[model samples]
Target: MQLPIAPEGKVRFVPSIPLALQHAFAMFGSTVLVPLLLGLDPRVALMMGGIGTLIYLISTKFKVPSYLGSSFAFIAPILALKSSLGLGAALAGAVGSGIVYVILALIIQRTGSDWIHKIIPPSFVGAVIVVIGLTLAPSAISLASGGTHFSYNAFWTAMVTLGVAVVVMVWAKGRLGMVPVLVGMIGGYAFAALRGQVNWSIVAKSPWFGLPHFVHPVWNWQAMAILAPVAFVTVAEHLGHLFVAGSITERDFFKDPGLGRSLMGDGIPTILAGLVGAAPTTTYGENLGVLALTRVYSTQVIAEAAVFAILMSFIGKLGGLLQAMPSPVIGGISILLFGVIAASGFRTLVDAKVDFADRRNLVLSSVVLAVGVGNLALPIGRFPVSSLAMATGMGLILNGAFLVYDKIKPEAKDAVEAPQEAAL
Candidate 1:
């Protein structure tokens, strides 16, 4: 049998640039939303996202079809940093967070994959992921309500954004099929912009090719303290992204590309984003949903998207326009997307085939949800652990430690054997 070839003489091995542009456009709205909420530069975030994609491609030898972008997981920390240290200092903290990723990548390089799974179990991972979504509920509510110390906008914009997001997800078609998040943001913001309150001065002042206002990390103990816990939670999120990408590509990226190298891809780009006044970077799960929707598995497309983000960064007017979007508009969109994220976590537990009939699984999951959602918190002596940090930390420790202990106790001999026998 002979294999067919394209007129361009391209093979399955060839990368498609146009497809990547479509995907980037599809994902870009969500990318900038993180910076907007955290009081950072949306244009810089785009540039960093684009550059971060390039860095990840370089770090991973251009093998994986993944794009690195702003992480929602760090939203809490960025806000906290801004409150205590100021925007410049907050960005410095974001830079510090990237350094932590580099360190984790090194650890993965030195050790093996076994250590990661053994240390952070699926239960812990699920809990941490859940904590990530639930921890932001207050912020989301405040945004939906009309903004607060964190973000500013009327509650109505948030409702509209959220409603539009849900409606689009339910009824969108063809070109509209994959980018519910972007659509919701645009739809909600458009309504808010027309209200005659959106500011265009910054957009007018923004230059097309001006140099990025790069800032170095100041030594901020408080910012560092609050953000440190996020590293543990986010490692799991990154791994989950890697796993999903591997599944789509039909290759264990964790093998050849390696987790450490991939992590450095996430880390290095993040450091650069912060330097230029962007926000913390990570793998966007929404983009993963896009990959699933589009089935475009080539890294070239992701690289192109990265370039779009980079070029878009220099468009000062556009950045100003995006910056001017009302907080309620963003809040409206967040209303649905954030809930979906939490739902995805719940699905992870169900898909893992966790034996809920067993009391052990029940106990672990219950505590994970309660501690994260109920606002059960702690004071780290003189330091005040933000709800986000405390919930994330507690979820990991409670879920990880309990699951490991349960696994070893041998109490589930029958439970463990059931799945094996069924396979036979």
Candidate 2:
């Protein structure tokens, strides 16, 4: 008998149930991760993430299965907003993030990729990412040190699991490597279990399926303003993800699927999430990396993962298991992912061929990096502020300012003469 034909280069007939389950699991793992870190309901992120993915599929014509959900980058901003205001207010800011992306999509429809370069330069975007990652360093440390939902015993368990996960991730080949985060999590949980660090009562007392924490929107002026800057950074991130997916599919998505549509896709869900008290929405880069690794591009696979995530939201035990994961393990993974994200900025700079010696580039890069990492801030009227979100906002504005100024000014006479002399 002839072998079953491979459903190569096609998206139909493959989004089956089993594949769907696997996809759901993966999606659940990735999206639930964000809320877990931020002390929000992981279940909320999962359901929203699944819903967001469905929206994205519809927007992108069900071609791209890339799951959208809680963005790790949005964590610091959300946390800062919560501390400054409250949860409802912080979520309101998340809704703003979707609006920001929709606006960018409109810009893209008008100006295309060139518009991206206008607002989001290598220096600016890089600085924003750096701020996003490094700003969370404190939380990583505190959590690893048993600050939240973890004990000293749990810390060691987490550390061991994290260490093994790191090793597996760094050393493991192929499919194993693709799931380092999950591996580290499971490994950590196993150790925590052995050490009796996990409280089974939390797991046993909860129902198998129940309604998750579904938050509703309430206006908060302070939080809205505080979290507004995340729009800039996460918007840039949105463009980056679309570009990546386009590159992967070898199709100009901006042409057919339409960037505006995709943003609308991501935006609608993000808005839904914000209104429903879910975390921020985003396309997970790591999951894309996994797709690349697994050679699995089936949107059905992602759909499966999304369903699993949706189902898991109702399971207290599953949520508890995620909670049972140690802080140090997350800390370890964050360190790697954070550095990689920062390095992505460096790569962007290199690709753009921005001159370090050029005064314009130097000023832009120096100011952006310094202000970003150094936590520089600009006070607007009465609010007291200094944070990753503010730093990123300041850096982006400055970077754009430098770009404009450099473009407007002519070369100095001395520099012009010096170039002529060299030519001579």
Candidate 3:
């Protein structure tokens, strides 16, 4: 692909500061929302997001433009683990997931990204991306449906939230256009408040300043089994995000900081968050959205944003306020957020020029979408894999098989044709 010419020059500190703040604001909603959904401390998520971003920047020598935050891909597994094994065990599973990233980094260091690309191409990556969102579709529906049962009020509020967000994202311009998610959440919250669904007591009773609860992971094999496979999902996500960032910046980051280093940058913080019993972190796409909106690719700007998130984590009231957000409001916002994620995956395929007309591509895409959207599960001995994991595994295998077949078939055909040509 021909790279576009990136605008050259260093970002001035004066403008960098506010741009960083904008980045932070851009990511705040999703970062906090993840922890709040799983009954984890929102403050801890904010703190880890900052710490993780710093870790990513430092690991990459402050060259990569990324901010780490709570991963939505891990949400279903974490929530499931939390329900069955307890939060500590759930976090321990996250640690295992991080270890998977570290392991992939080690492998990349040994063989490089080519080995990965051979087995998993853009179509597979795009399928995994869509699966990640589709796998979470039921959760989004359940959340928007009300606590345990369907509520008309909750459904409408969610619709309102999604509607407002779409409107803002379409009509709003400049930096303002970058915050449709936040605006949508607020709009949903206001609608819920009017319907007397919001509980203000928790926010009122919360302290203004306090330390975020930081606990320790409790090792559990079962939890690890469930959460660890998610690392593959994150792996695909990391590569896709890097590809997007590289396209935007006109720099082949796969060479500069390198994919191995990038994996390490993303992995280390996730391990750190898990060890401290916080939600696992991944590079924030919302912040990436901010990067696209602003066209500022400076790592310094993202670093500043990380710093702000770290500082904000100490504010107990802010965390409390996030937790106090009405369920319906959260549900409403979730519908849009999760749906956008799935859509982004589809867009990635389109951007990658994946040819669906090819039989192999069609089969792979169809199978992945069906399995993922349907949330089908297959048991491997005593262990069961989620739809996303199964889809990723299937995509890797199918892509690799087809790639090998494509390579070998031409050689076989040439060998047969050479004999015919000699006869002629």
Candidate 4:
């Protein structure tokens, strides 16, 4: 087996570009999808994604290898705010969400992250990671099926893409194996073109150079209230991603960079995204999958990918070309990537040696899977705490209850010994 690359590892420029492109390909579909769904400009989302990633890298002192992308968590809230108020108000809400992250970071900086562990133990963390992967399953499937309805062409295209990816993952050797996702996408796109699915007109019509549409945020207290609470969901997800990434790289990022710094890294980019009229940014699990597959955790490679993304945003033809990628092809790639993410979570459980025989462990895992996989939403005021956030919250509450039980419960062995001594 090839040796894994460390975060600080250096690579020659020629090979590094392809490695960076692999990471860009891994992030491309979903980064743009978030903005498209929310009726925002895809170019702005791509630009913010690259910019946010760079910001995050700097904030973490380039110790953590992650690619920041448009967040899906705030899609509903942003859309709702946009409809009821205006796009400006919705952007304000996103800014407010970033403020929440910053405040949390400040608190963590002072009080430390010990409380975070107390509320979210290892067992709960594993379950929350699993929830994050499972929550994304539907989106993968929807793309595979060609949106709301299933199409035979789409299914076949997805199968071809998935098959190529699997083959590359299992059989390919050396550098080729390191980019199964990118290779699979190329193969899938080729097949899609042959089948007359590729539309070249959009790319042709797009100008070679352009700038993203930027809008300033309009602050409204009501809009802030509606969108700010959703930050809690993304915050829980942010922690889970950090844990998973740390596990993959076999480095304690939380301790090295510290959770406080990581949160600030994430929050700062999100603030920039809102200010520039783009979707909020989050650490992408797709890129994490690439890191796991390639065993390459080089921050330099990620930075290169960010640069590519920023360049892609400014080049209208390039952005349009990516936009024209068939949904089925994206779906096919997603099947493998999303599955890897979930498998990583299971690996976390195994690595931690979590004992399901313990009732506390059993309850935490079972309840989290049920709530998270089932997509149960429990509303908190105007915000509905659902999916990953709800699952994480429920797991934390359950774990906290068990901890309290352990604290308050009397020692039965001591009571029995006392009675025996009295009788003697």
**Using Cα atoms with residue i matched to residue i, what is each candidate's TM-score against the true structure?**
0.85, 0.86, 0.88, 0.76
**The CA-based lDDT of model 1 is what?**
0.72
Q: Judging by TM-score against the true structure, name the best candidate.
A: 3
The residue ranges of model 1 lying beyond 4 angstroms of the native Cα positions read: 1-17, 148-153, 212-215, 358-360, 399-424
TM-score, cand. 3 vs. native:
0.88
| lDDT tens digits by residue: candidate 2, 69-96 | 6887777767766666667777887887
Cα lDDT, all candidates: 0.72, 0.68, 0.80, 0.80
Question: What's model 2's TM-score?
Answer: 0.86
Q: Pick the candidate with the highest lDDT.
A: 4
In candidate 3, what are the lDDT values of residues 336-407, reduced to their tens digit?
788888898899899889877555667788877887777776765545566676676677677767767768
Writing each residue's lDDT as its tens digit, candidate 4 over 1-424 gives 2459888787778888988998898787677767765667788988889989999999899989999998866764576567767889899989998998999899999999888666666677677667766777677788888888789999999999999989998999865765677688789989999999989897798889999768889988766766766676577668878988999999998888999999999999999999988899999887998898788898999999999999889988876766677889878887886677677678778977987755567778899889888878666566444456567667767777776765687473244334434756
Query: In each prediction, how many residue pairs overlap at the backbone (N, C-alpha, C within less than 3 A)?
Result: 4, 7, 1, 0
How does candidate 4 score on lDDT?
0.80
Cα lDDT tens digits, model 1, 73-188, are 78866776666567766776667778888888898899967777766666666766776677777777877777545434476667777877788789988657677788888888
lDDT-superior candidate, 3 or 4 = 4
Question: In model 2, where do residues sit more than 4 Å from their true spots?
Answer: 1-22, 25-27, 110-113, 148-155, 324-329, 351-353, 377-386, 406-424
Better of 2 and 3 by TM-score: 3
Superior candidate under TM-score, 1 versus 2: 2
Pairs that collide, model 2: 20-304, 23-304, 23-305, 24-304, 24-305, 24-306, 25-305
